[model samples]
Target: MKNCTLDLLGIKDSRLQFDPKYKNKVTTDDFYNHRKARFIHLLQSYPCFCPVCGKKMKRNGFKTVEMVGLPSGGLTNIFSIRKQKYLCPSSAACPKTITKLAEVQDVKANARISQAVKYQAVSKLGQNISQKYIATDFCISSMTVMRFAQGVSTYLKPNQHYLPQNIAFDDFKSGNFSQSGMSIIVMDIATHRTLDIVRSRQNTYLRSYFLQYDRQARWAVQTVTVDLYSPYRAFIHDVFPNALIIADRFHVITQAYRALNQVRIQAMKQAGHGSHNSRALKHYWKLLTKDSAHLDFKHYHKSRNFRNLQLCEQDIVERLLAMSADLRLAYNYYQTLLQAVHQGNPALLEELTQSAAGLPDPVKKTNRTLRKHRQEIKNSFETTFSNGPIEGTNNKIKTIKKTAYGFRNFENFRLRILVELKNSYVSLNFHSA
Candidate 1:
C-alpha cells in the first residue's frame, strides 16, 4: 500500500472491493440525502454579488425552499431551489438588504419556475401551443406559464424613428361588429415594415401624433399612400404639409370594381331567368375584373356575350393604369393638382370640378371626394411616395397574428410587434443596438 489514501467508506483506495449486502440496501432516500450536500456545494460555487453595491455577500441562511424553475417541458430540466438570503454589511444606509440568489432565476423569489425557463417556453411554443399544453409539457401550472410570458414581454422597448420615410396607412377591424375594434397602421414602404400603429382611427389621435413630431420629421415624410378617407386627408394636411400623398392604385381599383359588382348584382335582379344578357353578365363577371392577358381563351369565349359590361370595366381599369404611366399627360395634371392645391391656386379647384363632370357616376363620385380633399390627393402625387413598406409590415403583422392564433390583450400584442420590428431592422443592419 504505497501512498494509498482512504476513500469515503474509510477503505484503502487500492482495494477493488464489493459487498453483496450493499446491493439491495441502496435506496432513493439514501441517494437523495447523499446528493443534497453536493447540490448545496454546487450552489455555493456560484456566488452572487449585489449588482448595485458590488459587495461580496455571505449566505445568511436558507429563506425558503421554492419551486423556481420552468416546469420540465421534456426539453429542459426543472429546478426546485432552496433560496438562500444574504445581508449586506452597510445595512443602515443601503436600500437593499437580505438579497436572494434565486431571484436571478425566479422573477419573484416565490415563483415556481425561473424567468429563463419561462422565456424558453415562449420561444419554443409561441402561440401554436396552448397554455394548458405548455403547463403539461413543463410539468408546471398554466398560470406560471402565463406569468412567465408576461414577465418576458416587459423587456421590449420601442425605439425612435419607428416610422419610415415613405409609409402606408390602412385600417383593420380589431373586433367583431357591435364590439368593433379598429386600428390604424403606418408602414415603411421600402422595407415593408410596420412603422407605427394606433388603436383608433380617430383623426384627433392621428393629429396628436403628428403634432408631437418636430417640423423636420414632419417634412421628412416623402409620401403617404392611403385609401380615400376624408379624416385621414385632413390629418395628413395638418401634419405633413410638405409630403406627397398617393391614393393607392390598389385601393382605387378595388373601390371601382366593388361599385361595378353592385351594378351587376342590381342588373341581374331586374333581369328575368334565361335571359341571354343575364347569363352573359354572369359569365363575363370574372373576365371583366381580370386582366385579359392573364385570361385563357376558353374564359374569353365564355365572356363574349357580356362584352359591353366587360368593356366598361376594362376601360376604367385601363384608364386608371394609364394614369400611373409617364406617357399620359394626365399624370402631369395629377401632379399639378397637388401643387396647385398647396399653392392655393383657385383655378385648380375649377379644373378638378370640370374633370369630375365628364366621368360616370362612380368615377365622378370618387373624383368629387378627391376634389374635396384636393390638397391631400395633390400631396400624394407631389410626394411621389407610398406607405408600401408599412403595408408590407402589416402583412407580417397579420402573419404574426395568424401564427399566434390571436392575442386577447392588445398591449401584449403591441409589445410583441414592436419588439419584432426592432429585431428585424437590427437584423438588416438598419438599426443601431
Candidate 2:
C-alpha cells in the first residue's frame, strides 16, 4: 500500500494503481461510481474483424454495459465497457450484412457479473462464508450469488458416467427432511470423492439410479466395500453380479470394540459405581479398548497401585482384569479379531467364529452378527479396499452441511458437494488421473 497523504484538513488520501496484468485490459482510467457503491472503470476491446467476409472491419458505434468486476483490498469494482461494432456490408461475394458486438474475455455476454467475480463468489463458499455476505461484498444481489454458485456447480459436474472399478456407498442427511429424511452419497473409493448425492437411499431409488448406468459401466465394477448394511450388498448382487462384496474392516473392528466396551460397562455397574472396580473401569476404559500389541504403558518411579499398593503403571487394567471373567473373555475376543484382520488370517477368523458360543452375552450378539456375513468379512482380508476413505468423505459432508447451516434445495446441496470434491482439501480429479 502507498503511504497515506494528509490534506490541510487532516484527512488522509491515497492513490491506487492497476496491476500490470490488468493495465492492458483497461484503455480508459478508473473512477468512483456515481452511486458511490463501487469503483467503476472503462475497459476496451482489441481490433475487430468482420465475421462474414473475414476482412478488415470498420468501427461503427459503441455498445456500453455495466458489469461487476474483480475486487481488491476490500474495494468492489464495476466495469463499463464500450464494445466496438463492426459493419459487414452486403455484396455478391459475401451477401450477409450484420453488426457484431465485441466480446470481453473476462465477462460473459449479457451477464451482469464478471467471470472473475463469479468464480471468487463460488470460492468463498469453501471458506464457510454465507452467500448473502458474498453478495454484499461483491455489490450484487443474492440471486446473482446463487446464480454464480449454480454456474460453478455446472462446471464441477462429472463429464462422464464410466463405472468405477472400486466404490463405496454411504448416506447423509440433507436439506429436504420430508422426502426421505436423508440423502445417499456414492463415492469412488480410489479418489475418495463423492460421485453423486441423491435425495433418497431406498431400494426403489437405488435400483433405478444404478440401472441407468450402461451395461458396461455396471459390469466394470469389481469390488464394492461397505459396512454391514444389507441394502448395498443386495443391490450389488442384483445389479453387478460379478463384484465381490467386502465388508469394511473398520466397521467390523468397531463392532467388536463396541461389544467389548459393553461387557466392561456391565462389570463396572455390578461392582457398583463408587467401588474400586467401577472407578478403575471408568478411568481406564481407553486402556481396555486399545489393542494389547499397541499398548505402550510405562512405569514411573514409586507410583503405587491403589488396590495392591505395588509399583505399577497398568494397575487399573490389571485390577479390572483380575476382577471380571466376562470382561476378560470379551477383551480377548476383541484382540483376536483385530489380529486376524491385520494378519489376513481366514483360518483364525473361522476359529473365532466357531468360538462365539462361549463368548459373553453382549459380545456374542456382535459375534453372531459378524458370523452372518462371514464370507463378506473374509473377503475384506483378501482385498486392500475399505470404506475408510468414504468415512473421511462423510466427515467433509458434515462440515459442508454445518458451513451452510443446512441446505433446503437438494440440487444446490448436491452441487456444493461436487464443488468440494473438485476444490476442497484433496483436490482430486475424478477421471483426470
Candidate 3:
C-alpha cells in the first residue's frame, strides 16, 4: 500500500511514509471548494547531530505542514505531512534549545506548493498560452505563474561575449512596453535562432548595447542583413566596421511592386469609372504584375470585360498595359527589375535605377530610393542572406501579443517571448522562489 501511494504521487523519498488512518478517503475542501485528494504522511527521517553543537539531538514531537501538489485523477492533490521535530540539548557550545523541522523532498522549506508543480508551471509557460489560462489550469494565481516565468528567464539570458559571423537585424511592434513602442530582434542568419531582443531600437541604445561585447567578437561579424531603413545602415557602419550590409531583397522588390500598383490605379482612373475598360484595368491588374514569362499565351478563355472575346493571360496583360503610356513604361521597368533581382544582376539594377526618365512619379521615386542604397543593394545581390527568417520571427511576436492581448511590463513581455520561442531551456532542479 505504501509503495503504491508513493508511486502514485511520484515521490522517491523513502522516509516519507503514508498514514493508514485516512485510507481510501478523498474529500472536497471548503477553502478551494473543489474536489481534492488529500493524504497524510509522516516524515521519519531524523538528523543525528545538532548543527551548532555537533551533539545528538532529541525528538520534539511533530508538526504538520499542508502543501499543494500537482493535480491527479482530475482532482487537486494536497499532502499533509507530519514532520518530525528535533531539539538540541542546552550546552556550552549551544546554550539555547534549537529546533528544526524535517523538510519534504522535491519541496522547498515552508513553501505551500511542491517543486514538481512549479516545474510543470514553468513548462506550460514555454507555450503560446497566456498566464491566466495556465494559472486556472494549475489552480494557482497569475502572480505565481509570473514568478515561474521570471525564474526560467534567468537561464535564457543571452551571452554578452559572443556574436555570430552573420546576423540579421529587424524591429517589431512591442506595444507600449518599450519607450519607442518598438523593440529590436537580433537573429543569427545561419541557425535561425534569435540572439537577443533589445527593448528599444534607438541608435544610442543599440550602439551602447552592442559595444558591451568584446571588440574581437564585434569584428568577427562578416555580414548583416537589414531592411532599407537608413538609420540602420548608418548604425551598422559605426558599430561593425568590417561588416558588409546587405539590404533585404524583399524590401527592395516591395518598392517597385508598390510603384507599379500605383501606376495601375492611375490607369484605372483615366479609363473612366463604370466603363468596361476601367473594370478590365481593375480586374486584370494581377496579370499585369505577374511575370510575363509565366503568362499562358497558348490557352484562350472568354473574357467578361471584352464582349466575350477569347483572350489568354498574355493577351490580357498586353491590352491592360496599352491603357496608358506611363503604365506601359512602369510595367516594363517593373518586369525588368524583377528579372534583375531574380538573376542577381547588380549592373542591370544600377542601369535601370539611373535612367528612370519619362516614368510615373511613383516609379521615379522608387528609383531614387533604390539609388540611395545602391552599394548595400549591390551587396544584397552578391550575398545569399536575407531578412526572410527575421520577418517570420516578427510575425510570431505579433501573434504572441495578439493571443495575450498585449503585456504591460516590457521585461515580462520579453521573457515570455524568449521562453515561447525556445531561446532557452529550463531545468527542474532550478529554484523558483
Candidate 4:
C-alpha cells in the first residue's frame, strides 16, 4: 500500500519521495535573496537599451551606496546590487560605456525605497499625517519618505490630462492680503473637474493661456460662465470669439445680495442713536432681506419700531426686502421667458421686455446686463451648462488646504489639487462599475 501511494505521488515522473526537511532546506535569508534575484532577473528581461544605439547593456559591477530609508524605529534594508553597463561599438560617436544596473522597483536609481512605496507616499500627501509618522510606519527616514514623495510627483506631472470642452473661471481671495491673496481656478463645468489654477485672474495671464490653444481647440468651447468681472468679459471676447459668455446665476444673485447688504449697513449707520429703533433694527437685520412670511411673529414684533424710522431708511429696507419676493417672481418669469424664446414664440421678445420693465431698479439693472448679453444668457438656459462643478471643486480645494496645515507654496498646492482630481476621477470610474 505504501509503495502504491509513492507511485501515485510520482505519477508525473518516477521520482523517489523523501522527507520534506531532507528534500530541500531553505532559510528566511535564502528566500529573501532568491526573491531579490528573481526581481533583478525580471528587470534584465527588459534591458535598459541604449537610447542612441539600442543595444543590450552588460553588467558593469556592484556599487556600495547609502540611502535614507524608513525612520529610526523602522529597519533599513541596505543591500548591494549588480550594476550593468553597455559598450557601444563606435566609441568615438557613441558616448557609451559600462551602464549601472537598473534599480528594480526603486523610484530613484540609487534610492532605498521602491516605486510602490513612493506611490503609497503620494497617496498620503496633503493628508494630516506627519512625515515622522510615515517614516516610522515604513521604517524609513523622513527624508527618504520626502524624496519618494517628490519622485512620485515627478512621474505624475507629465501624465496629467487636461482635456475639457467647456471650462469656467472664478477667483477667491487667499485671505486678508488684498489682491495678493486672490487666486483663480479654471474648471471643466461639464465633468466637474478642475482644468487649471493660477495665482492671478488678470487678463494677460488668461489671454496667454487662451492663445496656447489652437484655433480649432478654442472654437470647441461653446460657452463660458463667469461673474460680472470686466476683465473676464474682455478676455473671453478677444480669445474665444465663437464662444458665448453667460453670467452665472449664482454670481448675479451674489452681487445683488452684496448690494442689498451695503444698503442695509448704510441705513443702519444713518439711523443714528435711537436706542429703541437701533436695537430693533439690529434684532431684525437678518430677517429684513429674508421673506417676511418666513419670519416668526417675534421678529416682526422686535422690528416694529424699525418701520417707524425716517422715511428714506425705512422705505429702502422695506423696498429691498420686497424685492426679494419680486426677484423670486422675476426668476420664475425669466424661466418662462427662456422657454418661450426657445420655442421661437414671436411675442417672446415683447414678453421679456415687459418683464424687464416690471423689475425693481436693482433687478432692472441686472436684467439689462442680461439683455445686453441676451444671446449668451439665452444660450446658457438652452444648454445644460453651469459653473456648479467649479463651485464644488472650490470646496475640495478648501478641504485640501484644511487637511494640510495650509500650503505656503502655490505650485505645490496646485500639484496637490491635480493629484487629488486624478485620484477622484480614478475612484469614480472604479465605483461606477
lDDT scores for all predictions?
Answer: 0.52, 0.70, 0.81, 0.53
Please tell me which predicted candidate would have the highest TM-score against the true structure.
3
lDDT of 1 by residue, 1-433 (tens): 3223113312222322232324332122211212211111112124557666777777676543433233221232322233556756656446756464534322554455545556666554444455666665655666666665565443443244334677677877654311337777666665665555666777887687667766777778877788777668778877888767777644544454554455555455556566764565565466445644443433222224544443454443343333223112332334344444445554665585557433445545655665665555445444545545555666767876776677777765664565456434322332232
Cα RMSDs of all predictions?
11.0, 7.2, 2.9, 11.2
lDDT of 3: 0.81
- Per-candidate TM vs. native? 0.60, 0.78, 0.92, 0.58
Model 2 scores a TM of 0.78
> Where does model 3 exceed 4 Å of error?
30-48, 423-433
- The residue ranges of model 4 lying beyond 4 angstroms of the native Cα positions read 1-108, 126-163, 174-180, 291-380, 402-408, 422-433
Worst 10 residues of 1 by lDDT: 36-45
Residue 180, model 1, lDDT = 34
| RMSD in angstroms between candidate 4 and the native structure over all alpha carbons | 11.2
Give a tens-digit lDDT track for model 4, residues 19-136.
2322232111222212211111111223466656666655454343332222221233322233334444445546655344444434466555544555566566546565656655
Cα lDDT tens digits for candidate 3, 78-120: 7777778888877899989888888777887779888888888
Question: Considering summed lDDT, which 10 consecutive residues are worst modelled in model 4?
Answer: 36-45
Residue 147 C-alpha lDDT in model 3: 94
Winner of 2 and 4 under TM-score: 2
